[model samples]
Target: MADERLIAALDFHTMEDVQKLVAELGDSVSYYKVGMELFYSVGAPVVTWLRQQGKDVFLDLKLHDIPNTAAGGICSLMRLGATMLNVHASGGYTMMKTAVDRMHAEADKMGIKCPKLIAVTVLTSINQEDWEGLGQAIQIKSAVVRYAKLAKKAGLDGVVASAQEAALIREACGDDFLIVTPGIRPAGSDTNDQSRVVTPAEALSNGASHLVVGRPIYAADNPVLAAENIIKEMENVK
Candidate 1:
């Protein structure tokens, strides 16, 4: 189902909030992104709990560190059985490559399937102005594409980018490479803190393999309907 492509983000601070949202959303959403806030708040059991519920988890820790440390962290998280894991693309090729290699080795050792490894190209919260303010010479889109290229070279399965840059990433990395786009606001939903937001249909049409939606789904009065509507929008594009 196209609904599987929609990843509901568990952005809550506690397990009670997470459980409530997940129960409310129910079968409309099969994939979930457990980002740092919820992850740090609840820890590894959250991933295990989501797994127990038969939902896929995208562990969005955005690991960024020295090659050995990053690799070690990924290897540790591997035991949690997350469906996907990501590192910062800015961590450099060696770091990304080392994480990928070690992740595979660990999976083989444990006789479990290795999670898809992706790199975070850029956070959707940063706009062109914010990027320039950080003294970045390259334009935001260009930098994102450059990072996507580097991520692919590092043997990553994909890069987390905005849908605005998804087509470019798809073109540069090819159709098979994953382009998981966050900052997805369905139609007229508030943009919230994210700077580069797109509607669910626009994101899928723009070549995003998956959409991570948080506020729009979790905050809606009827979360199940909200998620179903977004999934409908996603399917209609095909």
Candidate 2:
């Protein structure tokens, strides 16, 4: 159950904040995600620090570029010792395949386990209206399915999608393909900037492999208690 319940987003602005959160969460959660903000602030040093503390890290840089460029970037990320990493699915098949293959090759060369490569299908911050305005004719659900299929064909391990799309992605890509869900808000919590949101229990019951929680835990009055509550909710669902 602990394996499925959590992937706490370390969305801090400084290394100090990250250290505080790690201390607060302790072994209650084993996985931590370092997104762009924290990564930019502390760089690869943070990944080294997290490993020293025995936590598995997910580097969420969401690399997107030409195939060669994206492959180079993923190789560098693999050297940083990421357990998982993400690329933009919209970067297209060649770019996604390049990133995955390069990372695997580099890991093999270095005698380390290859990081699980996942693609970001759609950000949780956007909605159907936003997609329509951006020239997408299909609804959000259909669009997510489209990208999930594309990612699988491109040799990606899975995708980062909102929990609302988890069931459909599983249907389209099969049960083994990973779905790392973000935009999770516990029941009755403020939605903040996230538009596609679900409770941890809903995400788990709906077939999410991981729940990426940020504000609800980081901004809570008592963060440790907040994390424990989320773990409890996930246990109930399991």
Candidate 3:
């Protein structure tokens, strides 16, 4: 279904909002991303609850730390039964590889499937000027491509990047690597705080394997209809 391409971002601050969204949009979108705010407030129980409702959960803590510590964190999160997870590409190759290796080992020990290890290339909230200020010499698109290449070299499944960079990332990393794009807004929807944004069709056509949509759907007058409209937009491509 087109819903497979739409991973509704559960960026709520409380469990009540999460529950309402789940109940309202159940089965319309199979994948749900439990980002920092919700995760910090509710913890693993939320992941368990989402799974119980038959939804695939993406535990997006964006783990980044020393090699050993990051590895341990990934192992722990994998045991939570997440379908996808992320680590910062800027964390360096050793940290990413260590996390990937440890995740595989732990999953094997528990006889469980490991989630796709996606690297966070850059936050969509940032712009080219932001990168330049941070001492990054290249433009935003070039930096994203460089990071995606590094992640692939470190054996990551894919990367989390802005939809605007999806095509560049795919060109640099090839078709096999996954590109999970966030900052997606439907036509006429407010961009909010997201600086790098694209429509559902634009993202998918640009080679994004999945799109994380939050406020555009959740904050809408009718979330179900909003989600349905997005699915229609995605399906209209190609």
Per-candidate TM equals 0.98, 0.97, 0.97
Per-candidate Cα RMSD to the true structure, in Å, reads: 0.9, 1.2, 1.0
Residue-level lDDT tens digits of model 1 in 1-238: 3377899999998999999988887788899999999999999999999999999999999999999999999999989999999999999999999999999998999899999999999899998889999999999999999999999998999999999999999999999999999999987788989999999889888899999999988899999989989988888887
lDDT for every model? Answer: 0.93, 0.90, 0.91
Give the per-residue lDDT of model 3 (tens digit) for 1-238: 4377789999888999999999998678888999999999999999999988888988899998999999999888888888999999999999999999889888888888878998999999998888789998888998889999999998999999998999999899898999999999998988899999999999999999999999998998999999999999888875
In model 2, pairs of residues that clash are none
Angstrom error at residue 23, model 2: 0.6
Alpha-carbon error at 159 in model 3, in Å?
0.2
Model 2 ranges off by over 4 Å: 1-4
Q: How far is candidate 3 from the true structure (C-alpha RMSD, Å)?
A: 1.0
Q: Per-residue alpha-carbon lDDT of model 2 for 99-201, expressed as tens digits?
A: 8888888888889988899999999999988888899988998989899999999899999999999999998999899999999999999998999999998
Judging by TM-score against the true structure, name the best candidate.
1
Off by over 4 Å in 1: none
Question: Where in model 3 is the C-alpha error above 4 Å?
Answer: none
lDDT of 2 at 116: 94
